[model samples]
Target chain A: MAINKNSNGYIIIYTVVMVVIVGALLAFLATSLKGKQDANVLNEQKVSIMKAFGEADANFDGVVTMGRINGGEFTVVEKADQQAVFELLGNRKALGEATDNLPIFQMEKDGVVKYVLPIVGKGLWGDIWGYVSLQQTEDNIIITGIVMDHAGETPGLGAEIATAKVQDMFAGKALYDATGAFAVRMQKGGAKNEHQVDAITGGTKTCDGVNAMLETSIGKYESFLRGAEAEVEADTAAAEECTCGECCEEEIVEPINEEE
Target chain B: MKLSKNFTNPLAANNPVIVQILGICSALAVTVKLEPALVMGLSVTFVTAFSNLVMSLLRNGLPSRIRIIVQLVVIATLVIVVDQFLRAYMYDVSKQLSVYVGLIITNCIVMGRVEAFALGNKPWDSFVDGVANGLGYAFILVLVAFFREFFGSGSLLGFKILGDWYTPNALMLFPPMALIIIGCIIWVHRSINKDLQEK
Candidate 1:
């Protein structure tokens, strides 16, 4: 039983059959794994947000409150509506010119409250995005932590932004200088002030992208930040005034009671 | 005894990386860190072994004219499957490996083995040969990665091994360092093996 192995008909049929089988197998695997893969991405987003808050292991649901800021009005999203925050952040760039209504996550730890802001921007190669958490102090806002990730930056050069050593420089840096300008940036050469951090040596374009991203992304929430700041100051002032008045009244009442 | 030779020969005598010079591209690219190198090794092993076995099983089919094309389709399918699985279960490593995982489709070792051995061999024997050659390539990758991570970053598998005072050799972090290390390994390998040296 001898059949020509190199016949055109046989080759064509073999190619078609092989292509069909392989295509079917790959499609089936991709569809079945889509759920698990998407879950992984969602969990990674949560972890990045948590990392930006400096509580890498903390539970996301228990510690954070989600909100959105639009036209200086803040709307809190309930626990069930948390997916809205992620969706908005994912669509931050798509909203482009209409950058309002950006998502914000609030968490308090060790009596200090911080706001986690999702930032998106373009690098030299592709989209670069991350979570940046700013801590509220008595006078100014300081960066508590940051977690950056890139889509496609040159490895060991522009991609260094994802490394902790680079991200650590942003911590404790003030968003605005004493004059109240949005001064935080990745300074070229070397950083000499509190508002600036050293830019990646070889990643100038990517660093520039980061600088612009920080300014623009953080700028979108300026009104919300100011409003929150004022509220905190008023609350503290009221508490101080109450303590002072209570002390004076207690002393006066005590002396009157003694005379009686 | 012949079955065992198919498994053991590529581990040293017919080493795919140092001897056959196959898959040197990925060997150089992913060996910057020990973790990725190890993962890359395991990944290549999976692709090669499966492709070899599959090709060998199909070798008897009457289609010599399109065997190369068939081999390519099989290898590509396996690589994609590996990439998808990595993205699903090991997202971090997947990100770290980045484009190298996809590039595994082009690694010459998979096709070389399928063409050179698998086409004329039994399925189980071809599979063993594929695994052996894969480990051979991985052995060199891990070796290069060890020196690179140890000296370039003062770390092993992401754990810092050197003290703060120990400044790392920045040269080792670059790609050229991997080549130099490979050269050194080849030199050492030839010195011991003796038979690998040219006349």
Candidate 2:
């Protein structure tokens, strides 16, 4: 073959050889970094979970001590006899049927279990998600921490939802009442009580979305909380029987003749 | 060797985007913000200059049957190196650039130079040719980006250049503005350089 700068065959052979070399190099580099990349992703998830719990100051490397709600453990529970799946928004049967799944993390301390579950909802510009922890007693949920990010929202306005002050509002907020009615709401002007979370004035839509997300996400755990409460009552009853305390002794005395 | 007007001409007279109407795709896509445009300009410059140099050097020994393939191979190789370096160091910028950096392998500017000048010239002359042409491309891109970033975001290099009161024009962030800006540049360039006007 005549060698020429303009020849097509020369270019073909050169291209093939160059491509082979470059491809091999890229493959080697990718493989070498694969492990580190995977580890980074796992670390990020752990950090997100920790930050959600307001435990950002806790040492993440060492063994995490579980609190009353197992800070490290979470679970997914479905409401019994309810077709509506607990979701980030108010229960929508269609949306529930689509995902039909939830996550709950349990933090265990001295054999007691506390669970942190995640909440997801839509923000003004994009989707928002957060985590909330509940006590085994089913009395209320402590807003441990939250994380919010957006796709294309304005930087200073809607984006402020991710700020610390905004996320802090969720701490120690209750998800339900004695009647099992979900009362979580984002007040427009300001929160009325410690239990009510104040909405982001600039981010009204996002606040509404978050309010909806919490009701739906927490509502799904209704059945799980009921079961947990029942189990606790049974355990407490059994423990009381074993102890020869004043109450137990009185019960054993065959209810000293009511007339006397 | 006498410096043919062809060697220095494109830097201004036949500028790629502003004059020749080539490479406008990147000019619009990356110009939405300043930093990405700057990085994209430099990346293209590096690829163009080196690819031209390499192609000219091998022009003599290349087989007549496959010279174009060899040109593409050289351009593609240089592009990969640039892409890797960006990924290693400027990871955030690289992420923003995403697949656009890799798409440089197919940029018409690099291929056009190799075909037009590298095949006909000596390596040193070809290197200069590459630099001149690449600069011409960069000049247009920077001008477009300056306008886009300034009006669109009220900032430069992510710093707020416009005062607190200045509201950004959202339309500038989209790709359509790039085309309009490029058209304006061409109009101005042609108006000033009467010889460049279409007959």
Query: Evaluated with TM-score, which candidate comes out highest?
Result: 1
Best-fitting candidate, measured by DockQ? 1
Docking band of candidate 1: medium
Residues A1-260, candidate 1, lDDT per residue (tens digit)?
Answer: 77677887777777888889998999999999999997888788899999999999988977888887888677888878777666666664663345677688889877888899888888888888999999766556889999998876755567889999999999999876766678899988989887899997768999999998898888998877766655555455556665666554444333111221
Candidate 2 ranges beyond 4 A from true positions: A1-260, B1-8
- The digit string of per-residue lDDT tens for model 1 on B1-199 reads 3988877888888889887888988877888789999999999999999999999999898388788888899999999999999999999999888889999999999999999989999999999988988898889899999999898778899999999998877677668888889888878888999888899
For model 2, report DockQ.
Answer: 0.20
What fraction of the reference structure's interface contacts does model 2 contain?
0.31
By summed lDDT, the worst window of 10 consecutive residues in model 2 chain A runs over: A81-90
- True C-alpha contacts between chains kept, each model in order: 0.72, 0.31
| DockQ metric, candidate 1 | 0.53
Q: What iRMS does model 2 reach?
A: 5.3
